[model samples]
Target: MKRKRIPNKKWAAPVLGLALVLPAALPAQAATPAQAAVKSIEFVGMNAPAGAQQMAQVYTGASVKVTYGDGTVKTFPLAYKQLFKSTDSVGGTIAGVSVDANGKPIMDTSAPNNPVPYVSDAPDANSLFQVPGMSPTSLGGNPLSLVTHYEYITSNNAGDSAYGLVPASMSLTKIDQNKTTGELTPVELQKVDFSGVDGLWIPCNGSLTPWNTHLGSEEYEADARAYEADPTQTYLSSFVQNYYQDTTKKGNPYDYNYIVEVSVDQDNKASAVKHYSLGRFSHELAKVAPDGKTVYFGDDGGNTMLFMYVADKAQDLSAGTLYAAKWIQTSAANGGSANLEWISLGHATDDEIRAEIDKGLTFSDIFETSDKPADGFATIKTYPSGKTEYLKLKPGMEKAAAFLESRRYAAMLGATSEFNKMEGVTLNAKDKKAYIAMSYVEKSMEKDSKGADPVDDIHVDKISSGVTYELSLGGGQKDRSGEAIASDYVPQTMKGLLWGEDLSAPDAKGDTAADDKVANPDNLSYSEQLRTLFIGEDSGMHANNYVWAYNIDTGKLSRILSTPSGAEATGLQAVEDLNGFSYVMSNLQHPGDEMIVPDPLKTEVLNNIDANFNNRKSGVVGYVSGIPSMEQIAAAAPEESGGGQISSPADDSLIPLRDTAQAAGAKVDWHGKNKEVVVTKGTHTLRLNVGEKTALLDGKSVSLPVVTQFSKGKVMFPSGVWDQFAKL
Candidate 1:
């Protein structure tokens, strides 16, 4: 209980409303009734960018009060991040301009579902992978074992016609060399200090602590809300230290507001610190928790609150306790389900949970306050359910008891559809599992006639897509599995994470899937040694900025990189040290809108579009291979080769794999660079640094770190990498 050390980047505004959170109040049940009655609304304002001269107007209505999930309750108006100009055409498709139950947009739908088929701009597409043993440098080089390199650096909170931003790239190659022409060009190693100012630091989704910080995340807002929503936009604010304290613009030397935490050296760059107590309202990633105590971050904006900071005094992790997973719905919970523990968030004191109206609290207490209890939380009861889900609420718990469990501690503040949108998170420290990437995106948009925004339209009925879940850390307070240290975290029973999907998608649907169909989805990176996962897709087919990979056990469709610039792979880290797992991205919206600036008010006016829009966009470590081991795919093809064996898309109900072993001889570690790989595992173990010299493994003998002792013969270790010979 050493609480009260709250001085490290204090932020006390966003609805300190009143604070009173109650869930043990019980007995009001009409099963559960108290949601649906609170309207007044009106705040619609964001538009004015196209070369701009002066536009600042954004207030976009504000009345608050939203709670749904049967408990019902509603009010209207309020969505930030606007540019709207389009008019009608509902999800039908056309020029494009819909999204207003909150994704912002009232008109402008003339043309947007056209281009969707590019597979590499093909200047050799990177050489297609030079055959023979393959080539990310003969399989043993920059393949995926990358030491460090991530790019994206421009996002202060939306709006960009290029007041700043640029410098995007992709790299990593290897995979039986299908001739991607010898890959490797990518080399930025990390750029995100953009708060240092240059490209505006739009870092996008980040957080990789273990003493080795890298927090990144800076989605946008500031420069006084991007110059009050539109005055032509300028950006630069984690507060800009109170807007740069004094010095009138230009090289103000430093101060840069907050939410940064930089560090990546060994050549990877990154450097800042900020953290501003972890509050800015647009963050997108922060995972911490390796017993490093807790960090759990998320703001995804719109109504905001899926926090958790608890480090109190333990990990020296600055301060502690700040919970907000809210959602209880218990009638003895099951399937109809609802149970995400911890509540003691903050807004400072609890004037009634910072603000008002709590008849049994369910809307995040009206805007978060979950005070007290956080330091080492321990039970309020119930949390493990279904197979382990994602999106919200924890059940299997783990990561140090979902960071010390928090039961009935107090302070719950939620408002806005059971709590406005939250997305992406994964902490499967190998089975402890925890994955979430939600987006009811304003309860699945499609709300027009003022049911009050939701029908901003992105092809309605698929509700702008983007959802992922998985939990199962296994319960805390020692119901079992707590001190196991680490093992079992499957990437689902979810707790040590938070998609906490951070900002934009009040049904924005990946911004109308870039014109009549996004289905959002960005929230990726899984590679348990390539059981796979990747994802990305913020636009349509070729899936803009392409990146598929699914199959973690059977999600199926295992490899496809593509990318050259439909750019939107925002924040995706997968490192795997020894430079093996490579993938750092953060290309904020790179080729998105292709270079930006093509609204022409609406319609596909076509000014000459082509910043490499999706059909050719790959940078930020696109491919990386060489991880085959099952005695080298049983000598390169030998029935089942080894280990588990077949399909089911992870778990659609099992089936597949009993192929009796089938065989084309299996393994093939070849890393030429892009011809993708596919070996779900067979006791897999191909570890080649191929940095040079002494690299044999099939022939026997190995050793190469420090960049790789230095390549030359003896450099063996690729007995066909893992294998999957034809006809299995």
Candidate 2:
């Protein structure tokens, strides 16, 4: 691809010859407009100034003072960014330009000129990778490949609203992080193509497997009715036939809803495989135990059930025995613990399940064939005792029950199907416990006399405040391999480790009574090293949802970070760097609602709104790094140095002339006339428009290497202009 060049003559006016002259002596008062008018001009290259390599600290109101159980409180402020900003890193924006299968730019169908819109964007389920001693053939010569796996949430608005169309896919890219400055730059490498799995739907919160692969959860699967009702939708029609292998079974529920594994090689190539044996449901996250064989999954919907998939072999989820938890109430109340037993739904290989679907076996067929008694229960014969037990479904229907309608099958087989909006699940191997988040615990556990018999006595008042349960893995009879058995062993009751009611408090400003609770805990992740659980929320109860860190040992609940208004904190992953510094990677999805922007960031937030853009609501993925101790934060005070240089704490980079002009108490107008960006500091004024290399600096022409770019609706100058702005 050839790079476009800008005209230089239009920006080549002669300088005043005294542009670089600095006033040696000045009055106590500020310089007048005439004296301060810039006369000297010197164009410099793109390198940053000295000391720029050092990492700088930035703070924002989006912070929380976390009080630990040990009585230690530390305030951690969040450093955030929206879309791609040049000041963020040397590599500028790291967006993947949408391309066809043949590697050509995909032209927009709606545009008259058929312009190629860079629609393949938005980072989700971001996980960092550091593979040392990687072969040249693997990483294309880089011995160490530092990359982050980004799952594209949705392709476009149509894909989000339309259930028929499969959305955009995931991608892997090399991220260059400056060691000295702690700056990050993402470089698009390869788009992960799901050849085997066909494609994904609503790729949501995911987990980084122990074997170093990305496990992305396919959230909500389209109902079979949607596909059957509309055969004209080619995407749905193709998906039904390709995956299900039967056009007649258009509404086969088993075709979708599986955890897809994505592996990226050193060559920047990616391959995906759908783990059908893991069973299917509205999966929010699939977390593997330290053993890797036992996988725990959370169903993110109302009246769902928790699932466990025990693989035949370690680190292999391809072939597994799917089991559902049978919650046996040991205590009388809703928050009380309940003994958990895994009821075998069935076991089958991916090929075997697909073969059943190919044989014209539908979900209704399996449900109808299952044995049901008048009391509404299924019978399963015990292995050693040979005693027939009353459950909801027959044991023989594993092929259909486990793979097809897993939630219904589990419920029939005596699994607790009363969970409401069951979200992320993570296991603490060291502690031998697993944690599950229930976004609406009270609502989910509400008693219904007309509903199922198991939930008849369960009456709980609706509380939007969510809850997290910690299940104790009890001692169980071992299998031949001495592995902790699943079928026969029943776990001790689950305990409520953290309650949303306790976490809920008024906001710091005391503006509202219901301001500060962590509602709708959608994603949960456990860090073995820290013995802490990270909670990410997607809730409407609060103005902005937050990401919290709960210490299991100390029972300390800390609200670490919160999302902007109208956005959810997603893909929360806490990974320790090679230097052993713990960092969290999270995505702020669809932020920038004027109502949600804090008072401090209102101006900048409002300025970020671009009405003409497509992804105006798109948010950015940021890493919280260099967390300081409470003592350090208290000791350090704001500097009062007054210099021509101004810096942006958000990007941790030097502010451009536009921002600096405003900081210097000068008028800065944008999109005034001819969509131009005008900045006036002291007596000097600079004017430039988008897609123009010529800039009017103090009524004189100045040539730039490239046309100015817009980031988050603000005009941004190229890196080459940094040196010129430094002289101001």
User: Each candidate: what lDDT?
Assistant: 0.30, 0.51
Deviation in angstroms for 715 in model 2? 54
Model 1 residue runs over 4 Å out of place are 1-204, 207-217, 223-238, 242-436, 449-456, 459-466, 469-523, 532-573, 576-694, 702-728
TM per model? Answer: 0.26, 0.63
Q: Give the distance in Å from residue 571's predicted Cα in candidate 2 to where it truly belongs.
A: 1.4
With candidate 1 superimposed using the best TM-score fit, by how many Å does residue 395's alpha carbon deviate from the native? 55
lDDT of 1 at 167: 21
- Name the 10 consecutive residues with the lowest summed lDDT in model 2: 9-18
Best by lDDT: 2
For model 1, residues 1-728, the per-residue Cα lDDT tens digits are 00011111111100000111111111122131211111111111122122211111111222222232233333332222211101111123211111122222222112254322111111101111122222233444442212222223222122322212222111222222122222233222211323333222333455556554545554333332123334233433312212233224432111222245554333333355544344334455666655565566544433334555545444444444445554443221111124454434332211221122122322122122223434333212111110111122333222212222121122112311222234445464545555555443333222333443211221122222434445554423211113221212111122211111222322211222222211334555564543444444443322233333344343333222323223444434444322122222322233333322224411231221222232223222233333222233223322221222222121112111213122332333333233222232222223344434223332234332222322242222222222221111
In angstroms, give how far residue 199 of model 1 lies from its true place. 9.6
Which one is best on TM-score? 2
